[model samples]
Target: MTSATRPQLEPRISSFRQNGMRTDALVLSEPGGKFKYKKITLRDNLLEPDECLVRIKATGICHTDLNFASKDRGQPENFPCVLGHEGAGTVIKVGSWVEDIAVGDEVIVTFTSCAQCRNCETGFPGYCDRWFKYNLGFSRFDGTQTIEDPKSKKPLKGHFFGQSSFAREIIVCETALVVIPAPTPAYELLAPLACGVMTGAGAMLNIVKPQPHQSVCVLGVGSVGLSAIMALKTLARPPRRIIALDILSSRLELAKKYGATHGINTTYQKDLMPTLMEITKGAGVDATIDCVGLPKVVEQIVHGTARRGRIVAVGVGLLTNAVSINTFEAVQAGLVYQGSLQGDSDPKRFLPWLLKMNQQGKFPYDELITTYHVEEVAEAIKDIKEGRTVKAVLLWDTH
Candidate 1:
């Protein structure tokens, strides 16, 4: 073909390694502080041989994000950090050694793990040996930051949960990227599937895996609880009854819309055990999932479980807090209490499965989303705390 007739090729986009870029991010300057909007210059060290740069499209505001932002969770190592884990975006740059994914691929950024660990090798990245260091350590596995403050000229912690995605762009490890189909829905609606939605639904489907016609009581009807309810509906023979307990009547009502057979407004009841027992006909529930990490709530739910019933603690709480349980009573009832992280999900397999279920209308997780521009992140967090939004997604105009 003649040169004139040959198609013109698009110029290759500049990458962080070649030409470092600056972008806007919501920064937390101190512990228990508000996220300040600022333009940050990404450090040249952002990319590693096994990393890739993602242009963030949408990021979910998870309760875990709020907890890290608002409380001194004893992880001072991660303070003054960029906090966000549930991110969905397009890959814009790949390091020299990155082969599994490349530029232009759509992906969900999730928790990172050492693939060689026993748990990860066995399909449980959530329980990776280096879970705390990789996800909550703020920096990369080697303790390095990818972003810096322009004025202070100091490193700002990044790589949170393998992708500090509260910004317009992020540097993430290759393992953290879960590629999704090209024709998927808007990124905003798919972001939560990376964390909150997956955690809740996976806890039920993967970890709990409740038997058919059994009774289940979900404590705290937030995104996680609602997700559990939605997953329950997909079972060939779902639980006999799905009870939702939350202080907010609106959340309880929303729970019903998903699949809850009963709603318990805990605020009106002095004790939750009585109401839960009554709902289970004095036998208590066959399974209880505590989405509220409070010790008191865990105690109540522990007491409300029937003989041989299982209780899964799905909530995150203060590090110093501990739940007091009567060992004798638990043993007598053959009650099982376990803690689940990220719903025991193997994101690669689970995420695609979830997307397929969502496409089939078996999982309507999008119904819980409330979108806001990136600048309105603070307002979105407030709405989440006030029980106004089930899931708040921050949309970035990366276009």
Candidate 2:
């Protein structure tokens, strides 16, 4: 119930291998609370026929992790759960049925999906039919928790997004694993590509697919927005102008460095729509991406898009918040507004492409990372919330 009560639930083993191969993890015992590092004993014979065990080298601290931990984006029942998804690691063990991946393979663990679903079969696993249940349900498909308290024998919800890599190790389904070649970039740098980076870059490259000479604007120039800017720069015929908007001047400057042609500090602007229109010369941008997901931000982007333009909402905001839109104006302008998840990426195909881009210095997403040891996760979260870091990755001492 409180941080003071954490000691009672302290793991009996100090090291993961001490008691049947349990591992260290930052567990949230209460809703809207701080993460307390504790050891957790995973289920015996943990590998399901379709699952594999991974020794996490690093994991990115995504806003979604913080949102779920803070009870801002998910149900409170998920409390006392291991919350993390952007993970990269080495396959330490594999299920008997895994054919494509083997032990010792380097992989990025992403959101899970039922391969047989209509959306997944159609190549859009981000919109998988069991998406909510698999990724956010805090349990396996058959309703089993992966870790439990040793003393009380109570289930501590695990499998958040199919692999709760906030721990030193995790058990993940084969479908959620994206194998990459060895001798690649450092795990800490590549960890974010599993989620935030993919979501931003994938949205622009895969969904928006901006035409040459078209104008585009990205709101909330954080990790996702900046990734969008970097990805846009690689276009064979890049957009005529790439606009970056944020309340922070520092992020706006980073946006410019990354490739944004114009930067707008929303803090200084009385009305974003007017400034956006002025920048696009009253024609409005061809594509406007709302990466902040605030209702007000969504409404403002709707007002700033040109006729036949597309407005992509990538940010995850409160479910109860609603944005008001003028139906007549939207119909008259022929504007299209849609939402994207994980950039609508098929990670198996997209991660490798992104890795190649990064290797060529075209993506340069590594420049955005600021690393922290697993124990310093709280500090990393603070830096992110205060806009001091574009991306924070937690490096694990799994060796």
Candidate 3:
């Protein structure tokens, strides 16, 4: 066959070298369902000269990933999409247009931003004007794909969250990359910091800004809420009382360890608003942050905030879900209820700031981890859904 007529490779069917041996990952058709793990292959997209390719060392499974696959949440991306937003990897190739990021640099992929928008320029890229297409739109901000199916050569979606990182290799914008210190266990720690930890901790430390002697209640004790608890401890005049509410007993214990002064078992409490009121002596909490966004839970919070208090809802709820609030109470109580994105954080600055906190044993965010091998991803998801683990991480390094 002439060169002009040569067949192109499929999106998820490209060759790679593991210890100098050629290998390939199969890109199967979408099965259309929930986020269940199945064995899949990683493909090399033979990136353009101006693009950079990364060898993913680890990619943490996030609730966002699960939501994308959920029918209720309505992930716009069709089936066969490679889903992973929290990824850390080493740069393996650099395009001609790329300069700052070079081969062998360790980095994390964060929220995609225009970097030109007012919000992005102000260091809040979570609200970037073009984020829908830049991140969730399932292509580069410019609408393009890096990989193609090996056989059919059809374009495959790349750059989910600026890096479709579930596979072994990912292509990303030089600007989206955040370089970390070399040999810094980029696998386990970098992913959570990308979104979950940042959202939880940032909401408390950056958005809510709890004052001394105030009462704060965190409504969910998962990874996000746990991070919030830890962040609270670092603040001057941390909440005099930090209440963590969850149905699980073990998570509540972990909450106390992280800085929560009290843990409420909703299974026994039955009525959350009353319990919250009782805990705060009927004054209501100074701040109530809901890391879980079920309608019922949000409703309880609408009723739980003290007069002039703040309610920071950090969790990602279903797009269809809505909560009704009493306008009279909202006005009479002077409540400041607001939704937070990326905990109102600037990843370029916040990621490093958090690393320092972890190194000093001040964050203890690592304690929330339950590690697993990359191949055992399904089990990790199962553990998280079953409440057997708070957060599950896939470890790429045996060490």
Which TM-score value belongs to model 3? 0.87
For all predicted structures, in order, the TM-scores are 0.93, 0.93, 0.87
Q: Per-residue alpha-carbon lDDT of model 2 for 1-399, expressed as tens digits?
A: 221232221223222233346788888887788887888887636556778999889999998888787766656777678888999989988876777898899999999987766888778999998898788778887777678767666778889899998998888888899999978678987799999999999999998899876889998999999999899867778888899989999999999999899998877774778877888889998997778877876687788888999988898667677778899999999989899999999999999999999888899999999999998988999999999989999999733
Query: Candidate 1: what lDDT?
Result: 0.85
**Positional deviation of 91 in candidate 3, in angstroms?**
1.3
**Candidates arranged by TM-score, highest first:** 2, 1, 3
lDDT of 3 at 374: 71
User: How many clashes in each structure?
Assistant: 0, 0, 14
Q: Give the TM-score of candidate 1.
A: 0.93
Query: Clash number for model 1?
Result: 0
lDDT of 1 by residue, 1-399 (tens): 222243432334333343357888999977788898898877545477677889899999998888887656625656677888999999999976777797999999999987767898899999988888889888777766688777777778887787889998898877788998769678987799999999999999997788876899888989998998899877888888899988999999999998899998877775778878888888889988888888887788788888999998899677677888899998899989889999999999999998888889999988999999999988998899899899999999734
Q: Give me the runs in candidate 3 sitting further than 4 Å from their true place.
A: 1-51, 74-77, 397-399
